[model samples]
Target: MTTELQFFMSESKKKIEAKLPELIDSLLAPESLKKSMIYSLEAGGKRIRPVLLLSVLKGFNQPVEKGLEMACAIEMIHTYSLIHDDLPAMDDDDVRRGKPTNHKVFGEAQAILAGDALLTYSYQLVSTISEEPSKVVSLMTELSRAAGAEGMVGGQVSDMEGENKDLSVEELEQIHHHKTGDLMVVSLVAGAILAGASERDQANLRHFGRELGLLFQIKDDILDIEGDAETIGKPVGSDAGNNKGTYPSILGMDGAKQRLEHHLALALSSLKEVDMDQSLLIELTKYVAYRNH
Candidate 1:
């Protein structure tokens, strides 16, 4: 990571960590479950989704504090997804964010429960916003759909089913569009809408998010193929080892690189149409495309 990227990432993480306790406090249920919930919530991650949400708020000249709750809520949902995704039933990864996966630390049962709690708690937190009921309802709807069967879950199913098969480009896109792109696209849409952007502007934001999400997964595929374990902070070549469909598997390395570059350009171009300040958001897009971890 570049110094600037590291700086912003660290900054965003601090903010999210500070907000986490309160969010979890609101969801306090059985005391035993709290441990797993807090454990996974506090585990270190890039806070990319929250950062993107806040960036959209800043872009539209909205008070960042106003969106902080929604930002935290989205991060909670994202973390829940990661916890479940890392379970043995899914990707079966042993590590995440450079630490033991949640299931490894908390045991499979608790980890599964933790994901369920966080997913439910996210909607609760979002619904408690008190102001802008319509916006909150709309964002909640988007989030629920994105996290459910039609979005990430669907993408994951496709991924698992096609792991050992040769997947076409269209099929790969479908997998990514649901699994990775859906949350990202909807997150941007929610953020833009909450920030008072017009429908046309929000649609453009969705396009930017869709392209960025695809590019994000492509970079992940590249890392799986060629990234260093220490540098990428996880097991390298997991996709290939698992026989997962990836851009590199279908397209040559050079071709994948070209496609990533093309999407990056398109993302930047899409931002030009939004009638808002673009400094931080522009920087964020660049950071996403070039991120090494």
Candidate 2:
């Protein structure tokens, strides 16, 4: 990565990481519950959603401060989704970010409650953002749509239902567009909202985020087969073990790689329409395509 990109990522990640625990601590919930939420929040990863939101703000030359709270709120929702996603009933993942899954440490009931807490608390955080009421309402609506039945929850249901079935490429993309792409769409669009960006910019970012989200899931499918378990912080090849449909499974390895290239091109092209300093956003998009874990 370029030094500037590295620096931007580091700074953004640091800010969000600090805010997560602080937000968790601010809750008046039980100590154990707070600990459970903080545990998964602190579990290491790229913090990609918040970082992407911040990058969009930077691209608009807006004060990164305005995006920080919204960025952290979106991340809280993302973390909650991960905690639930790793439960025995979901992906049943035993490991995440090299640590034992939240349920494994907190028991399934507490983990579920922690996830619920984070999901609900996100709105409260967004409500507290000092922006105008209309902007806050817009963000709240976006969060609900992205994280609720219309977005991640819906995608997850499609994913579970499609397991062990012969799914076409378009069907797979449809599943991922809701399951993985929607929240990311909100991230970029929410950044635009905070930056007071124009309608054209918002539309461009919405498209960019969608393409990038699929690019993310496709890389994930590739990594599940080719990535090292230790490096990826989980067992490799679990998708196949679970009989889940994947880009490589449906498209073939070579075809999946070609598809990856196609989306990368489209994602970059979307950014070309944006009139701003996209140096950081462009590098961040490249990192998503090329990251090892």
Candidate 3:
């Protein structure tokens, strides 16, 4: 990665890490439930969604702090999803970010409640944005649509049904688009909206987000095949073991790599459609496309 990109990512991660605990502490919930929520929140990962939001703000010359609340909100929703995904009814995994999954550490019921809390709390955080009430509402609406049944939840349902079945590339793409791509696209859209970006710029950023989401998932599929348990923080071949439809499964390894490149190119091209300082975003796209974990 470029030194500038690395510096930006480090700053983003630091901001997220510093702010998340305070957000959780402000929630007036039972201590156990709060701990459960914080456990997964603190379980470290790349913090990509929040960083993506802040990156868009930075690209537009907006104050990163102005978007920090919404950024943390995105991370909460993401961590919540991970907790629920690890439950017995979903992926049923026992590891995440090199530690036991939420369900494993907090029990199934508490873990479920933790996910619920975080999901709801995210909306609360968004509502706290006072700079622009209308923009806040727009962010909330976009988040609801993106994270709701019409988006991520819908994609998840499609994924569950596609398991053990031979799914075509189109079908797999559909699943990933909704399940994994919606939130990602919305993260960028939320930042653009908060920054008062032009409609044309917002549209371009949304397109870039969509392609970047696909690129992120495709790289994940590749990592699942080629990465180790130690580096990836989860077992390799879990997708194959679960009979989940993925790019590598449907397109073969080389074909998956080609598809990854295709999305990467589309993502970069979409960035060019908007007139902004895209250097950070361009480098972040490369980071996502090539990350090992």
TM-score to true structure, per model: 0.94, 0.97, 0.97
Worst 10 residues of 1 by lDDT: 1-10
lDDT of each candidate versus the true structure: 0.83, 0.90, 0.91
Pick by TM-score: 1 or 2, better one: 2
Model 1: per-residue lDDT, tens digit, 186-237?
A: 7788779788899888988888888889889888888877888888877787
User: Model 2 Cα displacement at 96 (Å)?
Assistant: 1.3
lDDT of 2 by residue, 1-293 (tens): 88999999999999998888998898888999999999998996888888888888988888888898899888888899999999998888888777899999999999999999988888999999999999999999988999888899999999889988999999999999998899899999999899888889889988999999999999999999899987776789977887888999999989999999999999999988987788998998888888887
* RMSD (Å) of each candidate, 1 decimal: 1.8, 1.1, 1.1
Tens digits of lDDT, candidate 3, 52-92? 99989999998899889999998998899989998998888
Error at 91, model 3, angstroms? 1.7
List of clashing residue pairs for candidate 3: none
Error of 2 at 33 (Å): 1.2
Instruction: Judge candidate 3 at residue 147 and give its lDDT.
Output: 95
Q: Which stretches of candidate 1 lie over 4 Å from their true place?
A: 1-8
